[model samples]
Target: MSKIKTKFTERIGIDMPILGFSHSTDVTAALTKAGGMGVYGIAHDPPDKVQARIDAVRGQIGSRPFGIDIMMPKGMPESETLESVQAKLPQANLEFVEGIAKKYKVPEATTKTFYNTVLRSPSYFEGQLQVLLSSDVDLVAFGVGLTPDAVGRLKAVGKIVGALIGSPHHFDAYRDIGLDFIVAQGSEAGAHTGTIGTMVLVPEIVQMAGDLPVLAAGGIGHGSQIAAALAMGAQGVWLGTSWLATSEHAQGDHAIGDRLRGKLFAAGSGDTRITRGSSGKPQRQIRSAWTEEWASPDAPEPLKMPYQHALVGDLMTAIEEHEVDPLLHSPAGQGVTWSLELRSVAQVFQALSDQTIAGLDLVNSISKSP
Candidate 1:
């Protein structure tokens, strides 16, 4: 198939207009091989291992222009230790976590779980940033906190930098920063997201972006959704949730157990809920006993960021370690409905590309009608 030419694709030098972001390097590499731009989300990696991880992913995607995604929030703790965050845990929170653990019989994690590996502090973020600045990454798209200084640093290193924005108000800052691109992620997106729907958010950001390229995200898992984004004036589409269902993800480094994957495979659009339970942020993820417990009246008021993650980190790690199917869940968008059943990266990419072309043809036919 011929390349899908868009302003963003042309500028970024990719054959496809789709930009795939995932926490798994396997999915990242596979997306690149499948023709889209793959952006590896390394927020979970230990700071010291960032470079090695980048190298591994680069090795797989050989010579392809891939990117990395990180959460760079402003005003985070400069140097907080895990013990310090643990010390702040209230007795009530501890008891609540214990109760859940007891109910599920989750065992103590034998090895270091990803929860303990994540240190939401400035030092960790900076460590990763420094490594990326000198790595082979082609683009940097950051979410969560707004960091203006990092933009200059990334550009200084000759890397294309972009930010994921949920609102139109965020456009000016990126435009002023001369960001290479902007991704307007809507509320329907999995994980941390804003309240605006993609339909409204994409056009607003596109209008604000003007000549700057815009990639529409959130609740976008199919070719028609990509087509819709293009129609909204976006130059391309940025996808995160779609990659979660790919076969590469299931077999990746941090892949979930068969039970959890089964849950995701069978999930419907209504199976997701937005809650601050997992990360102290409003994250839209698949509904599970964990999320349901948080929604219950017995649940305590969730803590803020960093603290919230610290509070539940152990239990989340335990749930995954034990394969507690009832409690296990992952961040996913409403678009998960369309991506039901695991497919290979190549197959998913081809389907989306074909659908996008067909959708464009349909739109063109309708426009020329009497």
Candidate 2:
């Protein structure tokens, strides 16, 4: 891929003007190797494993620019254990979650849930932040909770800082926080997003951002979408959900990665639902029996932040652990419509680049014709 230079790609030093976000380290490294930026989602991992993952990515990419994303929801305890949080849960919430397990006949999990290890506590965020601050990673982005001191700390260590914002207000709050780049994630995005559409949000953010680089996120699947984003003044595209179905993501979980991969391949643009089921935030995920149950009139109002995650923690583990087909899901965007089949990350990356090149050529021809 020839360099598709943009403020983001040039400043961040990548070939393709696309940023890939995924929980899989392989996906992260694959994007970097394939001429794009990859940001490993590390909010779910324990503090100790954070450095190992960064080192692993560094090994694969060998000093290529890649990043890590942390999601820290506010108002969580300084530190709280899963056991302690579980004990304090309301009876109705517990029973509701229990009923879902029973309804689906989900098997008991043999291993501990990842969420069990991740508390939405301030201490937990601090631990992860400490890992990023001291590590050799090139970029740091906040997906949810934007810490006031985190940007300065990361910058101090000579790291580029970025954040995903969902609205104009969010941009207002973060504009002065010293972000090197901004991702205008519309509601069409997969998880933890607000109600704005990408078309409207991108231009607004771009104009408001002044000279700061803006990456248009959400609802971006095809090269035409990438071209459209550039035309809207976005310096680049920030993509996540599309990578969920990539061959790299299908690295096959020893537990149940295959089933999840199949589910993702089978899903479409219309198959997602915006619910508070994932983390008590309006996140778009593949529609499943679990979401349906939660959407029921009988279902209790979902709990907040860590509590909601805690309530579904084991159940989510068991679903993946047992291959609960109807209940399996991932946070994905409407762009998933384009990822109907599994393709290698490089293959997909090339296709997007080719299409973008063609799209830009078409635009150039049109402009010259008139």
Candidate 3:
């Protein structure tokens, strides 16, 4: 066998240690074809859609290894069926949302779409996990917190279980559960993120996880950042914002990518806020009118998980669709500007490897000179 590259490359059966984060199968397939791991996000897509996406990636990459990321929080909506959960939703939940919507002045349309997603099972996490297991996925990464029991089940199947964690506490929990890996996400990341910034969180998790491979996440966009993550003891880097600007991203809007690429630093600073008003739980998204409203001193406190997401999920959709006022758009990390141009996923992967290798050499040269 050829010599293994990074610690992550050896473990994931890839030539490069980069893991592309995107919901697009095209991106996943391209990354895998380029000799890196592609982690497709199937959190919101329905099972059929997920299956098709998986099939597409499989066709493009053949048996090349890839992974899937699912959003399954421990103890979220316990009903066996999505219909059951939707029907059984407490009126108090709706009332609670109405109160918050009024308090935050959230547009009526945005509230509807946000609620629909949380209540309906577009892709029930458990059901989709079953589908993923049926396929030839190299690993499974949970996009949210999970219980020890869930981790045990995943491990029993001889699959890697990667938990997305934001703090040292989360790192400790995943480590205790013997998770295969942990994505150490800092606040500078897009979409869902924790209060801890990447610079601080990456090292903390590397130290806390001990031997478990830590995949530095969040604001990692360029080779320098990836090198920094490796120097800090991360085995690899998990990327999203960088992928969003790629030609394969399916975001279908050059302007959106342009806006993201242009405002990378401006968008990633302390200006980012943690709010459950978006998808429940504390996710670091761009500060928007919606987040500002909920955070205002006079505004009412947001409800708990699922409830808050249920209430506002629909509204978010409406905002995206232009039916309601734009509140906030999903984004993460300070490394977005590095993704200024729309390159192929394969090109991006190659760039990361080249840059990381160059960075490592620089580090070694400096050490020798001293």
lDDT of 3 by residue, 110-132 (tens): 33322464443323666776787
**Model 2 global lDDT (CA atoms, 0 to 1):** 0.85
Clashes of each: 0, 0, 17
Off by over 4 Å in 3: 1-4, 79-123, 251-271, 323-328, 367-370
Q: Output the TM-score of candidate 1.
A: 0.96
Q: Tell me the lDDT of model 1 at 361.
A: 87
**Local distance difference test values of all predictions, in order:** 0.85, 0.85, 0.69
Q: How does each model score on TM-score?
A: 0.96, 0.96, 0.81
lDDT of 2 by residue, 47-107 (tens): 8878988887898999789999998777888657877888899999889888888887888
Show pairs that collide, candidate 1: none
Residue 115, candidate 2: C-alpha displacement in angstroms? 2.0
Give candidate 2 regions above 4 Å deviation: 252-256, 367-370
Range of the 10 consecutive residues with the lowest summed lDDT in candidate 2: 249-258
